[model samples]
Target: MTRTATSAHPLDVALELEPVGDGTVTGRTTAAYANMVGPFGGITAATMLSAALRHPERLGDPVSLTVNFAGPVADGPFTIDARPTRTNNSTQHWTIEMTQDGVVATTATAVFALRRDSWTSTEVAPPAAPGAESVEPTPGPEFIRWMSNYDMRFVDGGLTDIDGERGDSTTTLWIRDNPARALDFPGLTAMCDSFYPRVFLRRGQMCPAGTVSLTIYFHVDADTLSEQGDDAVLATARAQHFGRSYFDQSAELWGRGGALLATSHQVMYFKV
Candidate 1:
């Protein structure tokens, strides 16, 4: 029997939230978006940010966000509580948490700022990797449900090797929603977390690994986002250091025409 695809984009379905009053919102994890251990970390992060975006008192747009995965989030329903800790004339700060079974599973803080015309420049260069059409799409593992939702064309560093032969932890790929959805903050937020853990690329084998914390800085404004529409973005991620049970990965997402859209960093937990 053929499986029927979900009509709503996985990101959209995962981010669907219901307000429960007092700055609280609730959502559930969809099986179509599951990771090895739980829901993909990126979706969860976006869900947390969604609470803040949906908050009645929110101001402006997301400038920077930090999410801490305090514990594993089980499948089923979860709750997010967001509060504006402070608000200023041009900026706003918020604190958010996700809870499952009455236990805090994730916590996050975000800063939103109103943009104004100012001196703008980017010193970071765009990816020198081959164009997306020149490379083959990276095949995702069958166990990772979320991979099916994206079309990932890799220039280098994919899940191809798993026997400690690849020698480095760097991945460059072009990614976008599989069914082609327009770019938005929540969608961009989830894409930042889409890259597989660097450990899988370096070790050439799945060693228990997961992101413990993730942070992203948005560089583009709403107008820029609308211009992106459904086009693929180039993303490159590499590990800064790996020691003991933790390591750090940094990534940059570039939109069409080579405009830098966002930068992300994460600390991951791995078992030896």
Candidate 2:
């Protein structure tokens, strides 16, 4: 079946949650984004963020978010709680949790703030590359269903080998929703986690892997976000350290005209 069969975009469907009363909501896992062991971590992260976004008490846009995966989220229904831990004149803090069968599965914290005009500058330069159109789009591995949801045109460090050569785990790509949905905060949050595990690119092989914790810092204010439409964003990621069991991944997402949208950091578990 096509992703639009339900009329709602696949992402909206993936992030869908139902009101269960008392300021909580319930959601279910979708086959569209199923991973090897559970649902895609990005979708889960976005869902938890959605909890905060959907709350009526929410203030301003998101500035930062951190999701901790405590356990695998089995395919089924799960509950989420978004509580405003603290709120100030210009900022708000939140604590969110996801649970299945009354057992905690995921936990997250987020901060939202009303942005004001101020001096702005980007200390880092964007990577030099041709526009996204000039590059050829690569098909996602069929095994990972969620990858197909994106139109990914990689500039370098693609998943073209499994046992080839070991090298730096850096990937630069232009990406957007496959069907071209309009850009939004939750959508941007989802895209931040869309890259392949850095370990795969560095080791030139696939291993049992998953994100342990994912964090995103949004540099976008309301004006900047409104300027971003459906255009593909330039994204780049690399691994800073690979230890015996875990590796660290850092990434940046840039909108058109070198607009630094967000920067993210994540840790992943790996076993050779």
Candidate 3:
């Protein structure tokens, strides 16, 4: 499914395309979504649950997802919705929504896994942050480009600098996604995942692999686009757990000025 911009400033969802369901979607709360001081935050859980609701079919997919917390999510009224945007013989796509106070807080499109049997492997070094000289921020119009909400500067020496040192498992960078985009919450949420891979390299290990899966949870429906001015957001992330072939990363979201905004997490499977 394609993404669009919406009016909601914080918990926004962009439904540029027509919404297929009139009322098939609703919002709910889990312990994780409850507002309490703990590892998991409600805003992130709510955002994630809302995203999952976008594609009910995924509930049946073999893929499993877990969302960790960087901070606490606000408690408020939130909305969730989804619709099929495209379908073909081989695969299907859908969009997700998280809304509150008549605004789209977060929106995302998920492509369901379809070809489990079709398998192939190739040699590839994991995508790593380029050296300080090479990792300059490429700002542009593409969604992947650094939007106006942030001012991201690679930490000196690169994430690999901490190799095997105490606190080496952590990766820090400069980020500021702020000012608030007036109507593009989903697009803002999408960017949250874009920088996730950087945290994995904090260990400074050679991760000559790819993300088998990725999931992002929004912690306050506070997805700002260009309208919010030049506000900034910072992300501090670390690997929470890892196995021989898989691992998870947790992140904290901070407004550019240093106020805590939200928390997030992702589960990754290294390509074997």
lDDT per residue for candidate 2 within 1-272, as digits (tens), equals 11334477888998898988765999999998887778989889999999999998989999999999999999999999999999999999999999999999999999999988899899988888799889888988798898888899988787674457577788999998877777788889889999889888877788888898999999997668868878889999999998989998999999988999999999999987
Taken over the whole model, the C-alpha lDDT of each candidate is: 0.88, 0.89, 0.42
lDDT-sorted candidate list, best first? 2, 1, 3
lDDT of 2: 0.89
lDDT of each residue in 1-272, candidate 3, tens digit only = 11244543333332222223552354433332122231123234335544544444543221222333322223444455655566666555556555556565455455443444444342322223333233454342333222333345554324335354344455545443332443223433444444534434554554543343345433232333233333434456667766777777666544433434434566666643
Candidate 2 positional error at 183, Å: 1.2
How many clashing residue pairs are found in candidate 3? Answer: 25
Question: Highest TM-score among the candidates is held by which one?
Answer: 2
Worst 10 residues of 3 by lDDT: 32-41
What TM-score would every model get versus the actual structure? 0.95, 0.95, 0.42
**Residue-level error in angstroms, candidate 3, position 210:** 4.8
What candidate 1 gets wrong by more than 4 Å, as runs, is 1-6
How would you order the candidates by TM-score, starting with the best? 2, 1, 3
Q: List, residue by residue over 36-150, the lDDT tens digit for candidate 1.
A: 8789888899898889988899888899999999999999999899999999999999999899999999999999988888898889997688877777787688898888888
Q: What are the C-alpha RMSDs, in order, of all predicted structures? A: 2.9, 2.3, 17.3
Candidate 2 Cα misplacement greater than 4 A, ranges: 1-6, 161-163
